[model samples]
Target: MHKNVYTADNAAMLLIDHQVGTIGWTKSHDVEEIKKNAILLAKIATAVGMPLVLTSSMEDNAQGPLLLELDETAPEAFAARIKRAGIVNAMDDENFNSAVKATGRKKVVVAGITTEVCVVFPVLQLLDEGYEVQVVTDASASFTKIGDDAALRRIEQAGAVITSTSQIVSELAVDWTMPKGQALGKLLNLGA
Candidate 1:
């Protein structure tokens, strides 16, 4: 495995706070685009058998609820998702932090709604804990482009890898003939 790349074997996915209320306010990317990218990442995790952990915050209120499509896309992960009770930083929530730790994978592919807080907070903690963090920018968004860019810069400067859904797919699926590669290719309509 390449030292800098997170292949399927070395990585797990943490999809955070992609809730209806949060996504409805994101301005960094089109809502549909964010949904598409996030859903694809979830599918990739499932296809490659990568451990996945989903998280949400205060689903009963303004946070609304996690995207239902995510549950449909990766049902097993959805079943085990961490429903945080207003924890701004998911890592600060014991259950959420424990869930990620339980994956037993050192590299984490992360995406979330409202990049500045929901994504950046746990990401920083994950980095400090020695995990290789990959932030899928397109799949994560903020209330403004400036906020999103600032969050990306902060994580990048602190040793996290700033990435996109497509880059992640390519790295995890390094060979088109491999089962993971083939599954990802089919998802991307690349004629597996």
Candidate 2:
């Protein structure tokens, strides 16, 4: 079978603030479910060999520390790549965007906190630039369901694809015969 239009090799995973402080504001998705999906998103990249870029607003001297599980699922080397952008939408922030662009991959699998700014702005910008962006909706959220929906609508209008983390992982996996297929299945608790 042929590779998907934009294969994982051409893709990058950008997981935004899955921080402990921001979890409360994620009104679109259940807190427990969001954490599950976040870890699963991390596992997907590990399984599929996709490069992941994690970013947070401000960890040190900020509101609170990041989720411990976030660092556990994504180690120092992985988390070290995390951008310490003070801006909500790292993609809109010059330094953050430059750092992401430096990775040199066009396709992006993105998730973030508060869908309005953190998730929405970046997805639309990337889409406008002709980048194939998959916004992981379930893996992100906002202060309210209405806000999250609004963000989704804006990104869709801009021609970006809104999807769940699992959906993004499934699409990138493409088939059941991938090299790490079984492992991916296990991580997602598919019981394969």
Candidate 3:
């Protein structure tokens, strides 16, 4: 626990701007698949009692609202998970950054719609502060494949560990022998 390693209990999951508007630019992956990944990530995080923060862009003006499935995946999050104006760029919004910090966990496991701006900005800022940052690459996408690749490359070079929703949930399980073991195995398709 010197400074860099992270544990499940010490991690917080932040989902940003996953509104309908953001989903429109998800040209790097199948839209339906992204939704499933997002839901599964949130569900696992909630089930493990991890701290979760859900944010959206411009509900009143953009995206309209977070998808119902995303909201239902983490019911304990309940309320104003929608915080951005769907600004397309929210890198400098302290409110956005502050909301993330409020969760009080230094290790951030984050994913967002659109890989370049939404996901990269927060990852860089969080890294600057010495917080252990893990970016879920498969859980995020962009308007194009190029943007997705570049964003991921930049984030990786900036010291962010590019990861995935699958890895996080699997590691947290520790074992299938525990109560949650069988369920996680089945969800992850490790069942026989």
For every model shown, the clashing-pair count is 0, 0, 4
Could you give candidate 2's per-residue lDDT for residues 1-192 as a string of tens digits? Answer: 444344568888888777777877667779888877877787788677777777777767443456677677768524565556476667777766776787688888888786787788778778777778878888887888888898899888888787887677667666656666666667767765
| Residues 71-162 of candidate 1: C-alpha lDDT, one tens digit per residue | 89999888888999888999999999899999999999999998998999999999999999999998999999999999999999999999
Model 3 per-residue lDDT tens digits across residues 1-192: 435544557888888777777787689988888887877778877777778788777777656677778767777573757476545545456666677678788888888887787888878878887778888887888989998999999989999998877787776676777756566666678881
Off by over 4 Å in 1: none
Query: Would you estimate the TM-scores of all the predictions?
Result: 0.98, 0.88, 0.88
Model 3: lowest-lDDT 10 consecutive positions:
82-91
Give the range of the ten consecutive residues with the poorest summed lDDT in model 2: 76-85
Q: Pick the candidate with the highest TM-score.
A: 1
Off by over 4 Å in 2: 1-6, 61-63, 83-85
Q: Candidate 3 overall Cα lDDT vs. reference?
A: 0.76
Each prediction's Cα lDDT score?
A: 0.93, 0.74, 0.76
Clashes of 3: 4
